[model samples]
Target: MPKAGRRRSAVWACFTENTASGKRRVLCLFCHHDLVANPIRMVRHIVRQCPNADEHHKKICREYQALTVPARRRPVVGGQATEAAKSADALELESARVHSDASAPPTE
Candidate 1:
């Protein structure tokens, strides 16, 4: 049969018998433990929780976890307010300025 999606990651090599029902589950190669096939849980199991997992598997799991982590968002500079909050504050100030200018009598 043709492939269904992208090739599975090398990290999945540590697991097998991936079965789908209400939730997907896989068998850990090192511990023979059945676990949800979610990547984070798999990595955690191999790296920290699996008693039977060796250094090699733990190293691989750590690398996979590092790779899968979402990139850290850039921090807002100089204040606690985010960009959207600053924009909203600016807009409010601008509208107030415009409203005040409009209400003032015209000068010669």
Candidate 2:
């Protein structure tokens, strides 16, 4: 058991195939879709699979991303995510998407 003031880590490795090299990639907890690795992968995932992803999982991912550095920086796991965090995450994600689309370059 961990002592008081000390916490457990939530990071887990998810093995995925690298798009370019066809090699195995080990992903950390923070990078669920690997958008950080290759921006194009982020676009593809958002287009094809993410739309069909379960709502609950999407909520969790949003909450995890929107979580502030200080709050999430502390390692912990298995506890309920804060409702405030969930709501904030949803709003932030929506805003970000809107801004991104608005600023994107147009193609002929």
Q: Say which candidate scores most in lDDT.
A: 1
**What is the Cα-based TM-score of model 1?**
0.56
Evaluated at residue 56, the lDDT of candidate 2 is: 51
Over the stretch 8-105, how does candidate 2's per-residue lDDT look in tens digits?
A: 22221122435554554333223445434432333334334554554554554444444522344433345844445456777788799999999999
| Highest TM-score scorer | 1
Query: lDDT for model 2, on a 0 to 1 scale?
Result: 0.45
Q: After superposition, how far is residue 87 of candidate 2 from its true place, in Å?
A: 24
lDDT of 1 at 20: 53
Q: Which parts of model 2 are misplaced by more than 4 Å?
A: 1-15, 19-49, 68-108
Alpha-carbon local distance difference test for all models: 0.81, 0.45
| Pairs of residues clashing in candidate 2 | none
Give the TM-scores of the predictions, in the order they appear. Answer: 0.56, 0.26
- How does candidate 1 score on lDDT? 0.81
How far is 102's C-alpha from truth in model 1 (Å)? 39
